[model samples]
Every structure is written in structure tokens, then in C-alpha cells.
Target: MKNILLGVMLLLAMASFAQPDTAKWVRAFPVTDYMVDISDSIRLVQVELPEGTSFKEKQLGLLKGIYRDAQQDTGTIGYGRCHLIKGHYYYFTINHKQSGRKPKAEDLLYTMMDSKPVYNGAITKLASHFIGLQEVGGSALYDRYQVFLAWTKTDENNVIDSIVSDINYTGSYFLQSDAAMNQQIKSGRFAGKGVLDVMMATGKDEVFKFLEYMAIKPNLYAGHEWKVAEIFATWLVSGAPAVIKE
Candidate 1:
């Protein structure tokens, strides 16, 4: 009896040790390499604001100034960049157009206009709500042409809940294809288990948190009609589990 109990305990311990980490969760994506590029860019730009300036204040001022300058010079809307001073440490990608190219600093200075008070007010509300939920560490990206906003993981549980609730209430668009892309990886027989295994090994909680965020709204990326699943499949076939070949 004693021997059997000891064996059972050992088995359980082994299983726990075998569980994948959070990094593995991210690795489960077949298109992880490409996704890595995007993720890396996001990570690189993540920032936290200074104590005195609020995220809302910085965003509003930056947007107003940039928009005003752009209108005066080009007589059109353009992309801009804003830095938040509190909570999260990151830069935001403000859209002026549909192209994925980076906007010029000059353009960033031109998006601050007083003409669209109503629109600007709504934007302020939405931006502040999202920033409020973000962990002290996360980033946001705004698609100018589509008027869409997307965010990454943060460390605060309360902020996470706020972000999720706000997105649901606001009916904001998100990157649905990213979730679908991850789902496809999980659906595969051989690769699915492996991906989950890796994610569990890396950061299970973080991976699940990201998954939950994606499950919240209609995917804005879906409008592009790009078959992210297909892209993921091809990437998997070529090479997956970036840390390990095959």
C-alpha cells in the first residue's frame, strides 16, 4: 500500500513537470516566426508614462497637435505616434491611412485637431478605457483607416478585466485572425499537442490571457479576408516549434 501511494505521487509530480510553460503556448502557433516579428515589434515599443502626465492627456495632446499640423500642411489626415506616461510603457501606432508603413514624425504632430470634437471625444474615451485596463506593461495600436484599436497583454488582473469589459461593451474590433490562427495550430493532430506542450512550458497564464482577449470581439483582421489559418498551415509545414527544427 505504501509503495503504491508513493508511485502515484511520483507520477503526479512527473506530469506537473511535463506540463508546458507559457512560452510554449505562444510557440504553438505555426506562423510563430512571422507572429514573432509582430510580437517583437510590439515588445520593443512598449513603454510606461512619466508620473505627472496621464495617458489620456498625452494621447489627446499628441493627437491634437499632430492632426492640426498635418491638416495645415497637407490638408489631409495622416498617421501619428503617441507616448503614454503612466501605467504601461509603450508607444501607440495611430493610423492616418490603411497602409502598414510607419508614419512620419511630422505626421504624428499633425493629428491633433479641434474640428472633430465629437469624434475626438469618443476616441478619448475609448483610448483612456483601454489604457486604464492595460497592465503597467503593454502597448496599443490604432488603425487609422479602419478606426480600430488593438492591445497586448498587461500584468494587472483588474486592468485585464477592464479591457475585456470595455471591448465587449464598446463593440470594438480586434484581431480575430490571430486567435483563429492559434486555433488552427491547436486543431492539428501531431502539431497541436506539440504547440500546447510548448506554450505550457513557456507561460501558460500569459498564453491563455492572450487567447481570452482574442475571444472577446469580432476580428477586425477578418475584413482583410486573409486566410491566416492557411498562412499558419504553410508555416507549420515549412518549420514550426522555432526553438526546435522538424
Candidate 2:
């Protein structure tokens, strides 16, 4: 009898959360076509959210990451952030007006605060007792965050260069497995036609490019460049697939 009562309570709770007030939670924005550079090679095009997707209330969930804003004078996005939720990856942006300040021209990235997450099941639920929150971006306007996860391959080098650049910029290379690459790199035991070979060919060029990237954005993360290089080096070696399968 006790177990039955607890189960009933759980179902009721889920039902309450699943059926949110659409009027307060949902909003729509007009779609505009443009490109946002995510890396040296990868550029993002805004994609709209589905008709009924909603954002969770701020008290219900929160997301932690940096984001991009449009330049007021130039009308271009020269600054941005990448989403590295527990594991899933995305690049997101919010409106500068809603943000209550113009994105500083010198500031290439802004860390998000009090930003609400998407109320979607695709996100991983945490111990906070609320549903999971997914991060997204497209428009800077409210309720207009378009999902940014879809991918279509254009060129292998483009994919490789982009992911390598993203990994460096977001410091997400730290999240990837080294696959025992450190030892191989140190011992110079790379076998041809494999990860090591790829690294050998393009590693130097990528490093030089990353240095240039850092020169341009000095406010980027500090003290993690070496690790970033190590992580993305392996990614470059591995062909830098758009979706990193876990």
C-alpha cells in the first residue's frame, strides 16, 4: 500500500511538469538567414525551434556557459560561446537588448548568468529534482532559441578544422578521451594511416593557427592551452566528426 501511494504521487508530479502553461512558456521569433562562425572553418546557420517547444522557468533549471551577441555597429557576430553541457555540445547566442547591455566590442565571449534552459527530454536530468535543461541558440530575441544540433558534411578538412578549432576555443578538448595518445606522441611510435599520422601532418599548422586565435582573443580561458592542444590534436587525428558519439 505504501509503494502504491508513492508511485501515484510520482506520476502526479510528472504530469504536472509535463503539462506546462504554454502561454507563459512559449514564444516565437521571425527567422532570418545568416551565418555565425563557430571556428576557423565551421559556420552556423540559424535553425528555428519546433512550433511548440518551450523554455523551462528559471527557478526550475539553469544552464552554465558563454554565448555570442551581435555587434551593434557592424551587425556581425565576431564573438561567441560554445555549449558544453555535462557532455552534449552546442553553440548559443542571446539578444544583447534582452541582455541589458551592448556586447562590448573588445569582448569576444560572455559567460551566461541566470539563463534558463530548454524544457526538453533530450537533456540529462540532474539531482535538482527538475527535468533536464538543454541549451540552444539562433535569434537573440526571447523564446526564439532554435535548436543547433543538426549536421551535414561538406568536406572532411572543414569538419576536422572546425571541430579542432571549437575544441580549442571552448576548452572542451579536456572532456575527450586521449585514447593513450600521449604515450604514442612522446615515443614517436605513430603507425601510418591512423590518428598519429593525421596529427603529424596537420598538427603544426593547427597549432600556429590556434596561437593566432589566442592572440586575437586574449580574454579566452587561461592556463589550459596545452591540454586543449592535446585533446584537439587527437580529434584532428580522428577526422573530427560533427557529432561526437558517447
Residues 88-169, candidate 2: write the lDDT tens digits. Answer: 2223333333223333222222121122343422111110121111111111111112321221233223433543444443
Model 2 alpha-carbon miss at residue 86, Å: 27
In candidate 2, which residue pairs clash?
Answer: 95-140
Query: Which stretches of model 1 miss by more than 4 angstroms?
Result: 1-76, 79-155, 159-190, 194-204, 208-246
RMSD of 2: 18.1
Q: Largest TM-score belongs to which candidate?
A: 2
Over 4 Å off in model 2, which ranges?
A: 1-54, 62-158, 161-198, 201-230, 234-246
Candidate 1 per-residue C-alpha lDDT over 127-179 given as tens digits, one digit per residue, 9 for 90 to 100? 32121112112333232222222222332333434433433322212233233
Per-residue error (Å), model 2, residue 115: 17
> Which has the greatest lDDT?
2
